[model samples]
Target: MPALFVTGTGTDIGKTYVSCALIRALKTRGAVVDAFKPVVSGFDPKDAAGSDPARLAAALGDPGGVFRIAPRRYLAPLSPNIAARLEGETLVLDDMVIDAMARAAEVRDGLLLVEGAGGVMSPLTDGETNLDMIATVGAPVLLVAGSYLGTISHVLTALVALRAANARVAAVVMSQSLDAPDLNQTAQALIPFLQGAPLFLAPRGESWDAGALADHLLTDLRAP
Candidate 1:
């Protein structure tokens, strides 16, 4: 199956939201898209499951669950390494890579979207970072940056890290994670801010449809 991995400059930058939107968008095109959060930190009291995998699975409508795709889940609301330590499981880099590839293969004809935990260099294990994790996965990256203060630096810094790690970059996605008083001002600066990568605004809330977001992504994915 064709696949792309989504990474972000930092946490809470709307990676899951954008990822969900992408999966939902692709599904609209009659594409069976599978999403994976290789390592999730936060816990949801409802599931007693302190992980993003469950949330991502629900968002993607994964009836079988994210465990079908993700092999590890840590419970602490911290970096993966810290979370792993707190939860008593070692974050095995090789295992994660193997599982993700296997999951992508499971959906052989579909588009698989894998989302990384936290920022590129955020720790996944005692000695490994998300960048190292991405290296293991070896898939193209769809970098997500929030549309807020210092985003430009974060985006470029992430792009530099991706390049340093030799990860194929699919594109940079500037997400709307805040309610700016002047949406237009933010929109106008995105093109230049992203250093030529196409910028798409993710509308607020699940109430909004995913059309515009999908269209922007499709255009990027189709670009040479």
Candidate 2:
């Protein structure tokens, strides 16, 4: 099974947006796509209309509902470790890995999209970060970042951290941030500093389409 781990420079940087769009695009191309958000915080079961898990489930055609998409969720909008602690719970790294791998196995012939909770270094447990999850899962990463002031630095810094951990970054997506400057220009300026990972721009707008972006990724992944 081929799995792509989606992580961001930080929270609210469009990780879920990119993941959902890509999943839709892949499905448009006749690919069986499934996604999982291993752990989610700030989720309210009673009102999940605008939640990340709900959005993800919708993207996956609401397969088995939001709970199936993200099995681990907390009400506190904080780091997973802190949120877990606040509720008198703890996250076990091995257990998480087991579940993720099992889910991937279920879609062995399709794409398994794993979305991280926050930035690569965001804590999954007291001693584990999202970086560890990526490494343990051995999936290529798609780093999502916001196009804002100082974004280039943040993207490059995140690249360095992932590289140090020997994680393979498939690409870097500069998603348009609220009230940010032109995203295309930001992507252009970021190209020179992105090492070799391809830079992509996700324009800001409600009707923005990701079909073209999805084509680029499929072409790259299917290359001989």
TM-score against native, each model: 0.86, 0.95
- What would the per-residue lDDT of candidate 1 be over residues 1-224, giving only the tens digit for each residue? 35688889998887877787777777888777788767776654466333466656776776458675455665567887787788777788887787788878987877678888888888887888889878877877888878787776787888888888888777776677675435446667656645566566666677656666566556655566
Model 2: how large is the Cα RMSD against the reference?
Answer: 1.5
Cα lDDT computed for each candidate against the true fold: 0.74, 0.86
How well is each residue in 67-171 modelled by candidate 2, as lDDT tens digits?
888899999999998998999999998888888889888987787888999998889999999999988988888999999998988999989989998998888
Instruction: For residue 212, give model 1's deviation from the true position in Å.
Output: 4.8
Error (Å) of candidate 2 at residue 115 is 0.3
Give the poorly placed runs of model 2, Cα more than 4 Å off. 222-224
| Residue-level error in angstroms, candidate 1, position 167 | 2.0
lDDT of 2: 0.86
